[model samples]
Target: MMFDDLDATVKALFDDAAAPAELRAADISFDTPDRAYKPAQATVNLFLHEVCENRALRDEARVMTRSGDRYTSRLPALRVDCAYLATAWSAQAGGLKAAEEHRLLGLALRWLSRFPVVDERFLRGSLRTPPQPYPLSTTVAQTQEGRSNAEFWSALGVPPRPAFSVTVTMTVDPFDEADELAAARRLHLDSTVMPHAALAGRVLDHTLAPVQGAEVTVVETGARTASAMGGEFAVPGLAFGDYTLRVQPPGGPAEQLAVTYAADHQRLTVVLSQP
Candidate 1:
């Protein structure tokens, strides 16, 4: 039965030639607390031993828990997490010997060595450390029956300890504000540019006050409408059309003005007369 199952599993892998690229033979979540998984060495050893021993369980298998052990005695299933089975059983098909088994196990270990281990070296050697404390209370106790528990711990190469939680944060910069309302009203009307009074200088001092966080949005009818983000904004590359100009000053009232664009090369002066 075990041989048949193994044969079927191997055949299935070969049959599925176009497996998804995203499919992972083994997956580990860094954020998640360590789950008690069978060690590659132990899982391989147990499965091979079971096959050789012919002590296969007919029904359910006993699974271990953090709190205690449960009993069922079901035949063990192969897992990518416990990939040692690939080599162990592959060699076990022939005459079973220590040297051959060791060689296969070494290869499997090398293959799995690519993954990072949590605690590679432990200083507390043979101190007979009591069970480390865990955050969650689970049924899979330390004293689990059969080789599953041992295999799970061995795979991690570390005893079950505890899990942790973490958080990430980000900071945003405040917007800049500059413009004075007193300056907007000081400008005298110069030449009539097109729609409104045309001024000489780049800007009318009192006409435009120190406006912090002010955004200018120019909407062109029958054309594209664009908005100025952050600092200062002005309409450029504009063709003759009716455009709606909107300005929003931080902590102040919003102003919207409509103007018709003509081929007069006109300059429009925007002034906030009232404070």
Candidate 2:
């Protein structure tokens, strides 16, 4: 979700900042233009340079949504630094072309520097009204340690050009693929009067303290439930069989457990040790 938001946010910032400059708004383009571009026109291109996983912020081990009592599984959210190449372009034919290019580059750098963090007002589209309004951190790193700028341009098959690099850290939510796939139906079931077994447990962290709001999913089946007050959860209608359970708690890492659920073994306790 946040991947696209990052793109929109970058472009919107350029557009909003260029309004008073009387310069045409920049766009997402290549470092080297394919066609002739106006010298006065300021061309800005943002490219995904690198993505480094952020481990400092709070992370969601498991993404979830409650439909009544059942909690469904969704991929875990990722916190990352969206690195990009903010390149500017202008024509070089006219005598004043060099001045115009410098002006364009200066405008972008100055306008962008205004906001150490991209303002919410400048954020447009999906990012304008994000569900998780975590303000991304932006930075300009001219010299990237251990990486060669010459090698970068060579790989792009273009001559070296002046470009500013920016990194924005964003929290991205996991995508639910359920909508893209066709729904399956259970057409048959045993009508026998046998009682299904119950699974109950309290999730705990490495400290052995209760972890609240954890979701316990039976991997063999999609049935899952959330840990409530005191970190307790129960699923009462599970059929008797060997079950693989996945335990995921908010603010904690997910865990996997192999459990055998017969008449003698019903209650289960799970603990998470790693993130």
Candidate 3:
């Protein structure tokens, strides 16, 4: 179920693209092009071969929304790359088979190249309904790391054919629900209203260097703030309580620490390992 919506969206892209008469009747398939597989008719096969995190587009900032008296903080969605090996198959024999397959593959490439990013109109299932905030980036005929074409085909126990790699970058949310918290309230001492407690923190790497632009969040109150140039951050208007702080550096892993925010203990330090 991981890439179910993405898979459907990719298929929908192919289904909706305008094609020549020769490819109009050809079937679109997601099955592996292995040795035992043989198409009874002309087909376009997009076999999902690799999936991995796209670190270049990675974002660690939390998205926070405020309503009436409540706040909701959601972790940033992860950017992932889904790579597919696209190949064309034909049931015809000899020269005719090769010619048809080459033409179909060429047309498919042209159709896909038209859109560097998949259009929202072609999105399907969950990808279309609520709509993802991030764009679906696409790359055609790009070489992917970790595997060679010949080795991949050999592993599938099939002869290598003319194929191109298509990698689609999509977002996946780690949490289904956002963390909710009530608005922080001020304390009253006799006739005077005391200021609300605030948590101040600093972010640093294992080398003790300040990490700027790091996101810091108070788990219990959904209070969020970004570290300054000196890795300093302050979350204002927080009620005194025991809380867990989540610190995420840009393009780095997230780290959490148990903390207590009181009148005397309002500041802390967090060290994040280099990614």
Candidate 4:
């Protein structure tokens, strides 16, 4: 997407410079393969340079997923800036001439300066639909230092000439982690009045033996439990209320009892005679 915008904007700059027929006399091109071919017409070339993340426009470390579940992005986006070098060439029939080169270079600078910020209206392709972050700017346009221009031209096998070092920042998605659909889950919290105490009891037979398989059921809530070892029956998390405790022993008739429960109540043991 960035390359598309860069190409279109460069094309627009020349159109704004003058008519295409007139600008063609200068032979403006984004390609820079042949540096030895001295065209009869003056030439302007654009060369891509450095690309680094734009930390200034870095977003927060939080991101919202499409599903809208509770979460945050641990990684940040890759907001980057791309650099390009726009240079001019001479229009001499023999080889190269500094005089004609400077003229073309001046015009190049003038036309580019007219677009300190590539207007959104002039934007093309995806650069327009979901346009780049506001005015697709051209902030870092100047002469670069540290690296020798002579060495750069030597690598290109051409004499060094002044060129515009341009930089434009754009945001790119690091991943499509949000593209897939995800299931959303909700959390529910239940409030409690007072803490509940375990309701424990015991069941016995006429021979003073413990009832191991006795069923202890609450009539009010229909909550049930089986008698454990030593005929012990315990149920937890019951609220303070009156419950008709029913004990239905295996192969025996059921017995009922009216039980009132409250906070910090003491445990009780129920003895079942032969029924």
How far does residue 100 in candidate 3 sit from its true spot (Å)?
Answer: 0.8
Tens digit per residue, CA lDDT, model 4, 148-239: 55666788887677766766665566665543444457667632222446677678887778899899998888889999878977778687
Q: Which stretches of candidate 4 lie over 4 Å from their true place?
A: 17-25, 65-76, 93-96, 179-275
- The lDDT for every candidate, in the order shown, is 0.33, 0.68, 0.85, 0.69
RMSD of 3: 17.8
Q: After superposition on all CA atoms, how large is the RMSD of candidate 2? A: 18.0
lDDT of 1 at 114: 30
Question: Best to worst by lDDT, what's the order?
Answer: 3, 4, 2, 1
The candidate that achieves the highest lDDT relative to the unseen native structure: 3
lDDT string for model 2 (31-106, tens) is 3332333335556666676788777765656555556545566666677777777666654557576665667776
lDDT of 1: 0.33
Tell me model 3's lDDT, rounded to 2 decimals.
Answer: 0.85
Question: Which residue segments of model 1 deviate by more than 4 Å?
Answer: 1-213, 221-233
Error of 4 at 133 (Å): 3.4
Residue 242 lDDT, candidate 4, scale 0-100 = 76
Supply the global lDDT for candidate 2.
0.68
Candidate 2: stretches off by over 4 Å: 1-4, 17-40, 58-76, 175-275
Compute the lDDT of residue 29 as modeled in candidate 2. Answer: 56
Error of 4 at 263 (Å): 32
